[model samples]
Every structure is written in C-alpha cells, then in structure tokens.
Target: VKEICSYMGVSSDTVYRWVETHEMPVHRMGRLFKFKISEIDAWVKAGGANRKPQKGNSQ
Candidate 1:
C-alpha cells in the first residue's frame, strides 16, 4: 500500500482517509488493509476527485 501510495504521489495517511470515506477501492486482508492494482486502476478511472463545478463558469 505504501508503494502504491508513493507511485500516486500521496501519503499513506491519504490512502487511509480514502478508505475511511469509502472513496478508494480496497479490501481487508484479514486484519490488515489491502489494495489490488486493478482496484487502483478502476478507482482512478471512476474519477478520484470530488469537485463541484463553479457557478457561472464556462468551459
């Protein structure tokens, strides 16, 4: 998980927070946290950020 987080340029705490908020794909490996590479891919593809569009903003 640390390795994956490093690859994403985020800290372990950020990943854990994602888990807590159910924002990231993950599973419990027994009593420990586990995340598969596929899961990460899907999560990224599913849109990782939660941003609200600006009012009166034009693209």
Candidate 2:
C-alpha cells in the first residue's frame, strides 16, 4: 500500500477508497493488498483514476 501510494502520489486512504469506488486493480492476499506497476500504469493510461466520485458518495 505504501509503495503504491508513493507511485500514485496519493495517500493510502485514497488508494483504499479508489479500490472500493473506482475498481482500482488490486490483488488481495489474506489481509494484504498487492499491486503491480504494469496494471497501475495501464489503469492510469485508461483514465481509471480520473473519474469523479459520485454524488452522495463520501470518500
């Protein structure tokens, strides 16, 4: 999570929220969340992170 946070230039909280709200690609292992740089790059290139949060949704 920390690594991805650094890579994405966002806080850990934002990453978790994106995983829940924006379908951010992630792998869950037990209680851990793993991320791949390639997947993240693709997601960004595809504009997954540019989506605005929906109305009435709180982040």
Candidate 3:
C-alpha cells in the first residue's frame, strides 16, 4: 500500500479512500489489499487516477 501510494504520488489515506469509494484496481486477501503494477499502470493510463468524484457522490 505504501509503495503504491508513493508510486501514485498520493497519500495512503487517499489510496484507502479511493479503494473504499472508487473502482480502483485492487484485490483483497483476508485483511490485506493487493495491487498489480501492470494493472495499476494500465489503470493510470486509462485515466483512473485522474477521475473526479461524481456530483452528488460524497467522498
């Protein structure tokens, strides 16, 4: 999580919040969350990170 946060240049809180609120590319195993570098790269390229919260949707 920390690595992904640093790679994305965002805080851990933001990552966690996005996982909870947005459709970020992530997987969970038991209590742990996992991500794939390739998938993350693709997601970023697809404007996943640039997405803004929708109107009327609280973040």
| Best candidate according to TM-score | 2
TM-score, each model?
A: 0.69, 0.82, 0.80
Superposing every Cα of model 1 onto the true structure, what RMSD results? 8.0
lDDT of 3: 0.84
Leading candidate by lDDT: 2
**Candidate 2: 10-residue stretch with minimal lDDT:** 50-59
Q: Mark the regions of model 2 whose C-alpha exceeds 4 Å error after superposition.
A: 53-59
Q: RMSD for each model, in Å, please? A: 8.0, 2.9, 2.5
Extract clashing residue pairs from model 2: none
Put down candidate 2 lDDT per residue, 1-59, tens digits, no spaces: 99999988999999998887746889989999999999999999988898876766544
CA-lDDT, candidates in order? 0.71, 0.87, 0.84
- Report how far residue 35 has shifted in candidate 2, in Å: 0.4
Clashing pairs in 1: none
Which is better, 2 or 3, measured by lDDT? 2
Q: Write the per-residue lDDT of candidate 3 for residues 1-59, one digit (tens) a residue.
A: 99999888999988987787665788999999999999989988998877976655545
- Residue range 22-42, candidate 1, lDDT tens digits: 667778878787778887887
Q: Rank the candidates by lDDT, best first.
A: 2, 3, 1
Off by over 4 Å in 3: 54-59
In terms of lDDT, which candidate is stronger, 1 or 2?
2
